[model samples]
Target: MAAFTASVIPIVSFILITLAVRCHATALIEGLYCGKKNCYDVLGINRDSDKQDIAKSYRRLARKYHPDVSKESDPEEKFREVANAYEILKDDESRRDYDYMLDHPEEFYGHYYRYYRRRMSPQVDVRVVIAGVITFVSIFQYMHGWWRYNDAMKYLLNEPKYRTMAVSKANELGLLSKIERRKRPKEDVKADEEAVLRKMLEENVDVRGGYSRPSLWDVMWVRVVLLPYTLVLYVIWWFKWQWTYFVMKQEYTEEDRHYLTRKALKLTTVQWESIGREKQSELIEKELWVNDNFQAYTNQQQEEMKAKYAESAKYRRYRRYMKNHKPGPIVDSD
Candidate 1:
């Protein structure tokens, strides 16, 4: 048991240290909802204290430890403690939480608040401690990049993962996370897509050099600016290649060309698949347009023949010419 406890001591120590800082875990359950006035009221000020009265009381106590006035060894520390309590009582939300805790005394008992205190208390299938810790740790990774820089050596130097552990203890105490972003459902995504499509149809996408990250023109102008930079860089690169090329000059073979080609076409799988689908859509549209155009041409020819046999002026001229030339009297009026 001693060995087990000994092995667990570091973890416990870290957890207690974590809980002490995060409000939900470190603070007394009563601290949040307590209506009890603090040390400041009992010792520092009277119950009927007004703002001026409170300020006067603080000034008196402050002077006692004023560091300039009081030479008492711990007088400065007492002054600070009184000052902190006074600040909290003055704030509105802090005062509300204080009043709330006072009103609800039975809620924070051993597991009542953690196991059943939340608005989401009904779906209590999983132990909140474990679930809350996991959620906190996952979110912590995304924030601050605080723990990402940690290495094995850093851990050896006596570091607790600050962001992750703080988040976990805070969650354990019922503090909601700040980092979770709300997401839309599938239906909402479709609605958003339609809205964007409507906006696109109304406006031109071509306004900003047309959606290609850099259009060909953009690339060309960038190249124009980069030309001098490119030359300067090339001179540096040439010296490097000249030095290295001589070393490998005898061993260089055509095989290096294949590796160079492979590097240029690198792209994520999603991008390649998206390009394929867009090309397929274009091919389908082209086929349908060609078919529609051919059918339209046939209809137009039939309409021209019908008009020639009827009474339009241009058709009338054709009919007159036909009759004069003895092909047959072309019909006139419909």
Candidate 2:
């Protein structure tokens, strides 16, 4: 039994490792453009279209699809695609990379890596690595905890003191006679003791009401020991695990593909408009316009709103005004 239990770990680990690698590869491949439309296709031109032709096509599409100018329900999204195509084709350096990616997609395995390395240093996504570590730890903890608990239970059941306590408790619960009926003539003492312990466990009452001998759970203090870890695990599971799993599943919708494309191009949402045109032009010149200070501006606006509302005279007065209006007495529904 011990050998069998020990063997299962390596087998399970191997399976998990294999699945993770496959899932990761699938996710990366999903992000790469495969048999999809290129920038030229987006601008209604051929790959060999010169700058003049590309500019003309882009301007026509931009005017037609611009959210502020168009009345279509989804014009903003179309405009985003057109703008991204224009940005790539307009730049000489980026255009070359884009064209290379289009022609040799198999060599462009690192879509996200290339995109990020251009703006920042080359490093693995800390979020993905952290999430993977947390997942592995959580699984190991669950399996190890259960194993320890079972081992502790088995040890307590064989101890003479616990067996006596369990027998006494079994009498109170009217299970002593059931255990007696199962006893065999000239049975091994250890086997007889184990049968009695089994009957006691079935009644869900630990030996000596768990005062003398701790139950499997109490012996490990699983809840107390795991509470903080559980909270952190929950946060990772909620925020990171869902997205990671979704990517690994390799089920790309049209919207998902578009979002990934935008990320590869370093485009934030229409929120870029908030950065003002002059700053936008400067960032574009530096190749930083796609995802420039848009998020910082948004965070700053949120903080300002919080401070404004919190310090407002109306809010202060409202708090004091509510003091005079106490909640009325409760009336029972029954």
Candidate 3:
């Protein structure tokens, strides 16, 4: 008798729990979809309806409820409901989920899972979207780079110093001609002159830094495509670096020495190039290629900077202000 009572208690608890879960799932379904109406009912179809029947019903209902065709007060809202119902019922997986929800309303978690999964799923392929985005970004980057380069060229062409040099070079190359200028239209002549200037700038002017011309290889898509190759090269470089510095203790080549010197000066390739050839030659003459010499050079530069700053007008003004404002006892003039 005692054993039977214990078993009966568990069975009663199970039944109560099942009833509660079913009640919750039904409430959730009621809230999720078109109020108390089922998706099939929204599409005017039965549970046993086939895809063809479902599609047919959806098309009919959709057209009937369409805002343009219907004279109903809220055709737009009705159209949305019809479309939503059709969207769920049109897919086999979604339809199966809906059927399962109807059959086993006690499975509240499963119902929620299926509903969200369908809702959150993307309509387009993720890979295609990613590729499209990369392509667009690459194109924008390439165009922007060219725009900057052109702006730099235009600035150089307008500069008196660079223009003089460009004009001289263009004349030497037979690009600028008085006869051609006289014969051509004003617009044509101006275009020809600008073209000549640009050509000369391209050949003579070392347009470096951020204003350098764009390259296809520098684009985002190209960079992404070459990522694997870049990784391979990096690995090889790492091994080579380890071998050179640790195992072989190889002597630095001229290029390597120059690179080290630039590194010591904390200068990028663009910055080093902008410092001018004469200045570079002077730095090289100081034997900055050697670590000890580079350190000494750095110290000398710091001292020079300190001296220059001390001689500056701002520093002099600051010193004068500090001298006048020195902390001392205030004298009573009154």
lDDT of 2 by residue, 13-96 (tens): 999999766654443233333224466777898878889998999989999998888988799877877887788688776677
- In the range 65-164, model 3's lDDT, one tens digit per residue, is 8998898889998899899888888888887887787777778787888788777899788999999999899989999999999999999999999999
> Each candidate: what lDDT?
0.50, 0.63, 0.84
Clashes of 1: 7
Residue range with the least summed lDDT across 10 consecutive positions in model 1: 205-214
Q: After superposition, how far is residue 268 of candidate 1 from its true place, in Å?
A: 23
**In terms of TM-score, which candidate is stronger, 1 or 3?**
3
Q: On residues 47-100, what C-alpha lDDT tens digit does candidate 1 reach at each position?
A: 455567767777777777776788888877766666766665555545444444
Candidate 3 has an lDDT of 0.84
Flag clash pairs in model 2. Answer: none
What are the runs in model 2 whose C-alpha is more than 4 Å off?
1-36, 121-334
- Screening candidate 3 with a backbone cut-off below 3 angstroms (N, C-alpha, C), the clashing residue pairs are none
Sorting all predicted structures by lDDT, with the top scorer first, yields 3, 2, 1
